[model samples]
Target: MVAGVLEVDPAEVTDESGPETIPTWTSLRHLQLVVTLEEVYGLSFAFEEIRDVRSVGALRDVLRAKGTVPA
Candidate 1:
């Protein structure tokens, strides 16, 4: 999913993957990504939660903490 959003190889997307780690992960893409995740997971992210997501692992953590992603 991260690879699809970033337009990168799926192998390149891991827990460590993020904007800084992936060159294709532009700000615009990040916005689109957030929207996509929200829609796909049927959840909304708070501003601070979004800001706190620095990696795929972080995103999962945030979503899980918010009860968006299942445990």
Candidate 2:
């Protein structure tokens, strides 16, 4: 999903991948990713949670906290 939003190869994305590491991860793309995740996971994120997610690992952690993904 991150790769799809950023238009990058899935293999190019890692736990540490973020706007700083991915040239295509513009602010707009980040918003799109958030929307996509919400739609796909059927869960909403708090403003602080959304703001705190800076990387794939962080996003995964949020999902884990929400019980949306396996730990």
Candidate 3:
């Protein structure tokens, strides 16, 4: 999903992948990713969570905390 939003190959998306590593992960794409995750998971994120996610690992942590993804 991250790769799709970033318009990158899936293999390029590592846990550390984010704006720093993936040039396509612009602010607009970040919002798109947040909305997509909310819709797909049937859950919403806090403003802080949305603002704090800077990496794939961080996003995964948020999802796991919300019980949307396995720990």
Q: Which run of 10 residues does model 1 get worst, by summed lDDT?
A: 62-71
- Quantify all predictions' global Cα lDDT against the true fold: 0.82, 0.89, 0.91
**Tens digit of per-residue lDDT, candidate 3, span 1-71:** 88888899999999999899999999999999999989998889999999989999999999888887733
TM-score of model 2 vs. true structure: 0.92
Off by over 4 Å in 3: none
Q: What is the TM-score of each candidate against the true structure?
A: 0.87, 0.92, 0.94
* lDDT (tens digit, per residue) of candidate 1 on 11-71: 8988888888899988788878888889888889898877767788888887787687633
Instruction: Return whichever of 1 and 2 wins on TM-score.
Output: 2
Candidate 3, residue 21: how far the Cα is off, in Å: 0.4
lDDT of 2 by residue, 16-54 (tens): 999899999888898899889999899999998878789
Q: Candidate 3 local accuracy as lDDT?
A: 0.91
